[model samples]
Target chain A: MSSDVLVSVRGLEVHFPVRGEGIRKKGAGVLRAVDGVDLDILRGETLGLVGESGCGKSTLGNAVLRLIPSTGGSVHFAGTDVTSVGGKGLRELRRRAGMVFQDPFASLDPRRTVAQTVSEPLEVHGLRSGRRERAARVGELLELVGLDPAVAGRYPHEFSGGQRQRVGIARALAGEPDFLVCDEAIASLDVSVQAQVLNLLRRLQKQLGLTLLFISHDLSAVRHISDRIAVMYLGRIVEIGPASAVGSDPQMPYTQALLSAVPLPHPALERERKRIVLRGDVPSPSAVPSGCRFRTRCPYVFEPCDDVDPALQPAGAAGQQAACHLHGVVGTPVERTPEGVTAEP
Target chain B: MGARSGAPRGSEPASAVTAGTAPVLEVEDLRVRLRTPRGPADVVNGLSYTVGPGETVAVVGESGSGKSVSVLALLGLLPARVATVTGRAVLQGEDLLTMKPERLRQVRGPGAGMVFQDPMTSLNPVLTVGRQLVEGIRAHGDVSKEAARSRAADLLGEVGLPDPKGALDRYPHELSGGMRQRVVIAIALSNSPALLIADEATTALDVTVQAQIIDLIENLQADRGTGVIWITHDLGVVAGIADRVLVMYGGRCVEDGTVDDVLERPAHPYTRGLLGALPDLARPAVDGVVPDLATVPGTPPAPTDLPEGCVFWPRCPVRGDARCEHEQPPLVQIQGLDRHFGPSGLPHRAATWCTEPTSDTGLPASGTGSTALGGDR
Candidate 1:
């Protein structure tokens, strides 16, 4: 366990047991939602875990926090192996790692006031000295997320989508956790409000010096906020690199395709740029392809791609890593060009 | 095939009917106030814009900016008991606001059609996609059921749905989000309405699906000469489709111009902020944080509780003194460009007393010779 790493996940796998109704009597099959994966988040940096829906990004985040028990692998946070932690130890681990859910409306207890909702974490962690101290702390937390402390008395329903997200942020920060996992936090927000909340998160991350794992399908938002980005496909990291390098000069065909699909705000650029429309939908996690997970939809798939699963290897001008057969060719640096970087023909 | 071969020039008819000049849909001074228990609360106040035939006009604003409300009012879709609406929604010289219910119903499917956000909710779960599409066609036209069904399948095929016949049999729930949206589009185009109002129609779908839908709409509009009113908050969607852009804030038209004019050389402060705030993929990343993303602080003013003078003054980053606070800014013709604050006649132009020179602020040089945006009154 590295002390420098805030959260280190090693070959993490989460599988749900599915029972067969007619044919099979015993355990029928395992739904491999999260296949073997390894990732690490250093102190005070945002590690973006990005994938399409049902790619198990959320499941990975949940499993790491020990909200859901993993079928295999270890999650170590702050020099503690949390995979086997139970009861008090698990509670302590949870205190050091908090989760910010996707839907602010659904995640929050509607009946509870803002103060109560945020303070619940403090109470659960047994950090508060008294009711008065907890109240004050709640006020501070509210202020930290750019919400008025006076609004702490109000219910969640009274606030807008952006404000409710602020309250959710306040609650997540209540434990003063070293690591925070924001799972699609800004997905539900309006574009303008999304910007505000993202800026607020950036400010808070710097101020608190907190490590974060920001999970989202929004490539633009993820590229904006993440220091390092990990592109997930079928419960595997297909590419991992610095945000700028991955965004500007993507080596992976999948990453290039993903980036090209993002609509540019400017009319000139939007009309000018070529869009790569990937054929077919995202495959189900349970029945992933045998070799390369992305082989089913990858534009550059060759004969060898179906047979050999390429591990994530270094590519690009910078030391960006991508898992693709093209990059797997021996002693050949995948040259980056403006046309080559684009997914569209 | 005959219709395709002998079809009138797509762009000529709309331009010709109104002397090759008039807009397909011209909304002027539209106001919608809901009759609440307390009083009439103005949801959409004084909104105006035009959509040229075969051209797309986007109403860009945040959630409660009255973009949706104004369109709803135009369509006569709002429940009369709840909403008291006043405005001139003229479509090809016919005032929609004053039309009787029977006439409005006749106009609805054939004259104009609407595609709403959330295709899942908008579509009927119990009915097959075919049934719904045929129903829309039969409602407005004296067509046989078989003819409508074939037309429905053809429409679905036109929108790029695979195995249109099979898809038609499937209920809304059985289809993917993208497929369902296509079905909705098929229904919207069933009557072959001259105008299509899509209110956040593609917002619910993923980026790839959204691109497909936008392409479908653009293709259909080009082929059919259908005028489209695209209401959305996403600048990206607007950039892709709209020929003209209308920037709405607080139920008012702050800026209206060609896509290039509004997107590249945004004049209004609110417009500038919105453009600035959008995370530009082309821009170089700064310290892992995207730069030039400036957020307009404070929430949108509630319709029932709008501020005096400029409704945007409270949140406007460039707001100046008492004039902005006391005197309501009217949209005026600054140079040749007409800028109106509210939804009245194009004549009632409003430039803030504290207008700043266009050169210093990166605004387009005014042809109307109005004072700078931030100049003192």
Candidate 2:
């Protein structure tokens, strides 16, 4: 809706129908994977999307990229309604927006060389004049991601996991897209390699002036890379704020639990820190709980949480927000100490 | 903690072996080769380590570092037709490397147990989870089916699985990823083996699930007095559980010491590079758009196309000249519990090359006929 916004998703819902023979399940049953999500990614900022497994974080990212069709609402990219765009319009939109997948080994064609893998997008968009120019551009792209140009002739199998991911990044940047969605791109890599790739992505984003929608289940990694973070729970945004604010002082119960679960690198801190372990496993999306999706496992859940759904409201300092009744007077008032002081447990 | 007291007492003395008291599973000069189209490709070479009775030893390295291959070779799991293994893998006064096929099969489930990377692939899809656990139990022990089923249920419960009775009747697909991994652990622990090898057991699971599974494995080992050889590439997982850490590179133990010694003050150049690359929350943030991240350039050399001297010399950031390029640096103990590649194959010595501090440039000079010490290439 605004010029500064690169991608705006409002109430976007992606649901798949589940057919069964029992209990009025003919047409009423539907698996609401990505249900009613609202997010805004600015022009050149990295917006991180995080959640546990089966919490619909990946589904939401895919739906925003228009890789998967949404059942309801709209996605507006640079003032263009991507949901209504089709045929040539969709193809044009794809050129301006690219996605880097989780598994680099599976995403790249095994038969293609590194050069071909990076140049395929350029060929598809018909951006290059001749083979020579395309080859040169591929070499430059490889170097941009810290890979050697000499490695251009090698196949994907010859490289390690980190190198393959670099190739994937080079491919994503080939079409000169303004916005990119990296869905768990670093999850399959080792920790050391993960840091390298994350650093590379940040450098490339700044150099190219690109906006990134980084989706991952790893909290520490997302905190390191994101400018602002949005915490998702069962296809809904429970909290949205700056990365530092959300990580250090979480307002929602879900956010608090998620941050607490991350083990600190220092052994002393890890031993002293209290972990908020949720009792049960995550509920299935097809049978999501009514009202608050996290109410089933929320540690601070009460009677009011089951009946009334809380909307996203300002909770943290300044512009941060959270959708939880704890901040309100409905269940228990979140006790706050004096300014700049943390309430002791 | 309450869990610490629940640990079985018989295994307590075995933990001292990691303190150089007595080694349980000792492997020396272990070498494994496969007959490829390009002649013999050494998958595991000159790997040496010891896992005490109750100590949890971690062999950490990237893929193809010979961690998994060495463990599989010890159990005689590699196919005899394609692979040729040599050297000593002594377990409870028996040489596993020289044992007969039939004898090895008998010793596999009882003497040593193994859990693979992916539980779904390791388990049979058509068979029920209960039947699989019972099969592992009955394969080595003399027990009735009813007794085995009950023991299987208890094992499942020990792994923190909900409704062990109900889980026994369900197939692998019905359970979640975490639940399936718990079932695999139950199967691995069914025989009460003295030694357990978990090869990337929790690498496929989510972070929370990974933590839970690691805790479960550590608990089980404490109770059973089972020596553990945890093979993984994740440093985070290794830091939490390992008593002694062995840093492997290009099929050799480059560094081996206590977890605190290796993690806090890593002496090997490779080990230091790996630790420096890790994103620490406690560290101060770097300026500029991109943070200063340590990355080793070039890929690990393939086993078939390994360099002549040190296998890591091509990618080593602190690459010295003639010694690193002309002769293989043997694994030698360095100053104060640190181990690294050195010229002489002696103990209690540091690497022969300069012990200069690592610079922030992230890339050192390549070995270009210039030696740190005056030597011929």
Candidate 3:
């Protein structure tokens, strides 16, 4: 691992067991939300994770932050294995990392004031020993997110959607953490309000020298904020590369189709662009296809894709890697997933 | 006009030339006042638009912008007590706003169909997909149960559902989000309705599924010449699907024009701001560096507390004129446009003070917010 790597994850798995009918024993079915994934977030670099629902991008993000327990593998943060930490070590880890959720409406407590929400993080970390100092810090954090400090006494319902999201950011940044994970942070906001929040986040990241793991299903929104992009399929990363390369010339067929499916706002360009529409819906994670998880919907499916799962290998572009057998090195034997039925359309 | 004459014609789509005349639905000075806890709020204030046969008119706006409410009013779906809808909604020849309850009910399914964002909103959880589709079909015609069942299967096939025969036996919960949406679309189209009002129908689906649904709707509309009202906040979907676009802000039609005219050469500052906010995939970043995203500061005003002046005056980046603060702007025709999407030839219009040479926006004549946004992304 490089010295600049702030957080590293290896072979992470988050499988959820399914139950039959009303109350049967743990069924044979296991939903592999994040199946054996490897990822790394470099210091001061924004890593964008993109995928559709049920693709495990959110689970991978939550696991890296240690917000949820992982089934297997490891997550290393600042030279420590976060997955194994407990008690004081975990509390210290929480102080060092923060997260911003997708829905501001649900994430915030309706009863709490903005100051209380922001100051609670400060109190939990035992920072700013006095109440006055904590209040000042809360005011500063609110201003940093472009909200008025005077409004800190108001409840979330008193503010607009954009303002409430700013309060959420203030609470997240109250920890003064070096790393932040924004999981669809701006997805719930309006198009105009989304830009304001995006700008605030970019400015904050640069100002504080914070590394961000920006995860979103909206491809267009994530493309601008991310330095590097990672595309996730059923439960695994299929492609990872610079944002420009991934947006323009994606190596994996799934990424190509995903990018193509996003309709551009430009009328002339939208009409002229060639769309590579896939055949069917994404297969259920419980019954994932054998070999390449994306092969079931991949237009460039070949013989090796039927049984041999391709590993991420160096692509033609610099610092780019893809898991498709078509672009990467062949003959490397990887574990094969069980055979499964096709998706129901 | 009654249901028969006002209804859109057969499967053959009308040509571009015939679209300007004989509009299927014409809404004139449409207004809706909802009795809220605070007070009576004017949600839709004199909003107007016309949808011709085979044309898809997109009503684009964010939440609380009254895009959805206006359509509900036109269809007489709003409750009488909670909402006071006063508008001239002429469908074919009959006035929907003045029609009796029985007449309005008759105009709902066979005359106009509806698709919502959540497929479950339109589907019955306990009933099978086939049963719901059959019920909707049988309600309009004198068809037998077996005939309606066959038609329901055919509708499912048309919406691209796999194994249409087997799907008839499955409940709504048995299908995926995309499949359930397809089933809903099948039910909506079962009666061969002349009009379809889809309110964020594909917003919940994934992009791949959204693309499929968009294509399906476009194909169905073209073959059947169904007039469509697509209510959404996503501009990308509008650019791809809409023949004409009506932009709503604070329950008013802020901008109205053909898709090419409105999207490519937006005249209103609100429309320009909306375009600047969205990250355009086609707009390549200069040298490897992405420009800072443009933003319109502050949020839309609440319906109850809307400004007496221009609806967007509070958040308008190009509030160049002094009159903008004290007076409301009318929907004026935009002048000196270089090109037009001639098919609709529907004159581009905007309800703003800054779309003209007289306003002198003090920015670029292009008015695309290129400089304000530190070079558009």
Candidate 4:
């Protein structure tokens, strides 16, 4: 993996104000969606960001691409501050970085043909000059994502879920971006079809040498394509390391729990696996736990974990880092599950 | 093939489903044809399976493989005008498909319960959890509202929902996805149903929450002797929970066997392909590069335009076999009755022409696609 940083993020934070407009009155609080996240993407490596539903993984990914506004911190793309740029520079950043959204059904327009949908980026970025050129480029992009260009005339409704995802990929790659963020790209696809889309993304990444951020709730899919994996919780990344190192010998208790929770496909192995059943649900983002967000459900939570949130440091495994008190980086490592510990909502 | 896997499950007789007790739910020749805008579509075709007491029968398939439709059809959840369901579904000695509307409604709560994929949709938005739970309980019997209310709280407590009493007063929107799912499970178990149909129930939750919910369901099933029909596309979950696995393709049970007989020695080519597509976590990346996933080449056939013969023939990689193209293959026995399996008398059966050719078959590695998933399983 290349050490040259493609995208450098420092203390990136994205907070959403909970509004009680029409429906049930939600208490007024700032939901710290992406809170103080620091990460770096290698020049051509695929980094998988994994977490649960409300972990702000998607928010962090959007912040990296400047798709959504952030509350605090800075995002530097290609050695330049992406947060400061506006107008043409911002548009240029958008062109350089493409985002493939989660839902393919909602991402594409029902009225627009596949060609029109794919060429929208090319038109906006003014990549291909003429209509004929744009159509040709769209065809190339379609082929790049393993779609037949002949179906370019058809509407989005005519295609299957997997095919619609391929069209979405084609649109995301229209501007010839150096960086791509696939936010739950294959989550909506079927089990068999997910692999097809994942394979296509891996192939495209290799062919173009594009820096990729594949964000998904599914750890198995994330582990498959990512060279490096980052395990996020609530808002912060608890662990980041080489995919094999993290997937195999994870240092962080949260990472360990997350890995153990994933059900294996082998019956013998699955039955024999030691599953760490977390007590309660993920704490609400609006009311995140005092110090470490994961401490509420962490079985190995210590006194230091409740006071001082440990920052990412060199963990036990090589090239792996974890932000946990159990690392003994500062506090005593809590090896056993604390007794009589129960978290309340 | 390492067929003698010790099966490991026969030891715990109390919790584990026994060999030959009468099935809680027996579905035979089940078919559901829907009247879509295009035309009449056969969503489910000739499905057969049985779920004994405390048995977890997992129906594994892709999205439109009729996993969900079959369950919905049996429960009479599909709109009557749009659906044509013809099946023999005996749930707790009652025919779900042929029963009258009122009888089916009566059977839904105590006889058979369903926990759907989306918690937001399954629950009543306007009604509180306590009210809904009590209403379900009172509808079945002449219990007092106060008694039903306490019972509702007890059900919530049983489901491991925190502050069960306080949670009953709160709305579904107030709870997290995992919490909402717990409430749904609590309601599903309110009447102590003999069978529970969870259609992609934990798909919405994260891995950790999913595990908790799974454990809860397993424990509940063990205590109540409730047969579970778990409909999910996740092979990982099917591995952990299922006593019997039914691999569905194009609305048909392509393969049905014990976890070992299917997962370890997958008979049907489709099952093999499905297992091949999964990414095993135990697998290590080579030089920081994970191996390429093996994808089944094409998407599933749409219900409106299903193939004339074998539904999988259009995408089945094992092509040149003449029997595979024009004729629908029946469930052929892949392996005879294995004494090791906890649930007895059920052999490994695959509805494909490829089951007989075990030696030198072009099928992918039987377990997960990875090398680490090979013999260790």
lDDT of 4 at B163: 82
State the C-alpha lDDT per candidate. Answer: 0.78, 0.77, 0.83, 0.83
lDDT for model 4 comes to 0.83
Top DockQ prediction, candidate number = 4
RMSD of each: 5.4, 5.1, 6.2, 5.7
lDDT of 4 by residue, B1-377 (tens): 01111123222343355457888999999999999899999999999889889889999998889999999899899999999999799987878899999998999999988899999899998889999889899999899989999999998888888788998899898888888898899888888899999999999888888887887887778778899999999988998999889999998998888876677777677887787788878665766567777779888888999887678888876644566678887776643323213244457677765443332222453432211111111
Per-residue lDDT over B275-341 for candidate 3, one digit per residue giving the tens place of the 0 to 100 score? 8888767765788778876677778888998998899988887676776788888887765443322
lDDT of 4 by residue, A18-66 (tens): 8865677765778899999999999899999999888999999988888
Predictions in order: chain A TM-score: 0.92, 0.93, 0.94, 0.93
Q: What share of the true interface contacts does candidate 1 keep?
A: 0.47
Order of models, best lDDT first: 3, 4, 1, 2
Off by over 4 Å in 4: A1-3, A19-28, A331-345, B1-18, B286-288, B335-345, B356-377
Q: What is the lDDT, from 0 to 100, of the residue B370 in candidate 3?
A: 22
Per-residue lDDT value at B171 in model 4: 88
Residue-pair clashes, model 2? 1
Identify the candidate with maximal TM-score: 3
Better of 1 and 4 by lDDT: 4
Location of the lowest summed lDDT over 10 successive residues in candidate 2 chain A: A336-345
DockQ of 1: 0.37
Candidate 2 wrong stretches, greater than 4 Å = A21-28, A111-120, A123-140, A147-161, A190-193, A263-273, A329-333, A336-345, B1-22, B284-290, B336-377
* Alpha-carbon lDDT of model 3: 0.83
Q: Candidate 3 chain A, which ten residues in sequence have the lowest lDDT sum?
A: A336-345
